[model samples]
Target: MRAMTYDTYGGVEVLSETRIPVPKVGPGEVLVRVRCASVNPVDWKIMAGGLDGLMDVVYPVVPGWDVAGTVEYVGIDTPEFTAGDEVVAYARKDYVHGGTFAEFVTVPVRALAPKPASLTWQQAAGLPLAGLTAYQLLTRLDTGKEDTVLVHGAAGGVGSLGVQIARALGARVIGTASARNHDRLRELGCEPVEYGDGLAERVRALAPDGVTVVADFVGGVLDTTRAVLAEGGRHASIADHTVLGAGGQWMWVRPVGADLAELGRLADAGQLTVTVAKTFPLAELAAAFDLSREGHTAGKIVLEV
Candidate 1:
């Protein structure tokens, strides 16, 4: 199998393309013939040793968590899927080793979901991590039709999906982004607010009573969140652990097949979608990482395998 690997934690310069043996399927796992994989900031962060204390890593690491592919083989006792079934998954394992940035990846049955028929392979590749992040956060907050939600970093991968998911839940969404992405937010059924100076006022202008729920995808916005949250409002952050000190939850997405399936159902029902900002061939994994690190892409960056 052709895959990108890094021998040590560093930067993109350390990544190299090489041929390696196909990974073995264990019980409760399935081997996926990789069609596409999506790049998230965590991929590069893990590569650079940012998560050193959180998860163990093996050398010659293949880095990627989001996969959209076909099942080529299923392990003994894994009856949830079989050969030729299309699937998508947030395939983060307990340790960082074999990953989705290759010709094939072994996915646990717990993280596997049938691919949404309405999405292309590229779009499906992008949905797992970002969609799960938004879905979990909003549902944990119990976001509902009566609530007004504010989404920080509204045009990025997770926030973009956050906007759509909030809308699908019938909540009124106010998303913060640059003017360039404001129209895109509107198309996703969110009221767009520019994210610079006076962000709180901008949000307040949209909802005079302050927002009922806040989902912060971008870090460093706890103050703005405080300023715009209604009394008894719920809030959470995927990026900022500091949120834990402010009566909010610091969330990490879990790979649950049932949650991913619900996201797929939303996509199939035309209530959700993923935007592909750009894509690179499997060998260009480093370039994809560089683009995601720039922190300006409005949608998911993907790798076509």
Candidate 2:
């Protein structure tokens, strides 16, 4: 199989397309013939050694985690899915050589979910990590009813999903984005606020009582998660750990197949939607990485196998 990989962590220069052996199915695993792979910020972070503290990697690393494909074979013990099932999943636990950039990759059966019929392979490929992150932050935190929520980086993948999920759950959502994205955020059922020039004040103008929960997808110096959360309210970040030091307690996004399936249902029902800003062939994985690192993608970037 031809796959893209890097023998050392660095820039896109280190990435190369080469032939590698196809992965084999294990007792509890399924072999997926990958059709598309999605890029995430964590992909580049890991490539640059930014997440070495949390995840260790071997050389010639294959960095993709989000995969959309068909199950070509299922292990004897993997009864949840069978060959010919179309699936989408986050394959982080296969981190050592989770080669989503290849024609085939092996993942545990529990990680796979039936892909939504309404989404194309590229669109579904981008949903596993970002979509699941949004789902867990709101539903797992019990953020339903008339609660008010703030979403930082609302134009980005996870942030955009968080805004829509909050609104779907009957929450009043305030999302932070650039002036250009204000209209787009409004279309997603959110009150959009610019990221700078006193964001807290802008959100206050919308809901003076303060937001009950904050979902920060941008974990930089300007992250206003602490400022937006109501007193003693919950703050969750899908990005870096800056939110951990915020006044409110921080929550981490964990992958849950049940949660992802619920999100899939929303997508299939047209109650939830996602954007794919760009798609690259699997051989151009290096360029895909560069595009994701640019940090201004309108939606998720995908690599088609």
Candidate 3:
């Protein structure tokens, strides 16, 4: 199997392409023939040791969590899927190693979902981590039709999906982005607000009473979240742990097959969509990391295997 691996934690320079043995499938796992894998900020962050204290690392690590691929072989006892099944997964394991950024990767059945027929491989690849992040956050907040929800960093990968998911749940969505992305947010059924100076006022202009739910996708917006939340509102942050101090949930997306399958159903029903900002070949993992690190792309950065 061809994979992008790093022997030690460092910058993008630590990543290099090499041929390694095909990972052995264990019971309750499946070996997927990789088609496309999406890049998340956490990919590079993990590569650079940002998660050193949170997750154990193994050397020669293959770094990626989002996968869209075909099941080539299913391990014993894994009866949920079989050969030739098209699937997508948030393929993170308990340890940092043997990931989706390769020709082949083994995924536990717990994280795998059938791919939606409406999406291309690249789009499906982009769905798992970002889509799950938004879905789980909104779910935890118990969003509903009567609520006016505000999304921070609404044009980026996770926020884009957050806006759509909030709308699908029947909530009125106000999304924060740059002026250039406001129109895009509107297309996703969100009222767009420009983020920056007076962000609170802009959001308040749309939801005069206050937003019933706040989801912060980009960090450093605790103040803005505080400014516009309704008196009994719920809030959460994927980027900022300080949210915990503010009566908000600090979340890390979990790989639940049922949740991913629900997202697949949303895509198939035309209630959800993924934006692909750019695609790179598997060998260009480092370059992809650079683009993701730039933090300017509005959609997902994917690698076509």
Give TM-scores for every candidate, taking all chains together and pairing residue i with residue i: 0.99, 0.94, 0.99
Q: All candidates' lDDT scores?
A: 0.96, 0.82, 0.95
Model 3 ranges off by over 4 Å? none
- Tens-digit lDDT string for candidate 3 (128-217): 999999999999999999999999999999999999999999999999999999889989999998878998998888889999999999
Residue range 79-137, candidate 1, lDDT tens digits = 89989999999999999999999999999999999999999999999999999999999
Among these predictions, the greatest lDDT belongs to 1
Error of 3 at 228 (Å): 0.8
Quality of model 2 by C-alpha lDDT: 0.82
Better of 1 and 3 by lDDT: 1
Please estimate how well model 3 matches the true structure, expressed as its whole-model Cα lDDT.
0.95
Please identify model 1 stretches exceeding 4 Å from their true place: none
**TM-score of candidate 2 against the unseen true structure:** 0.94
Q: Give the count of colliding residue pairs in each prediction.
A: 0, 0, 0
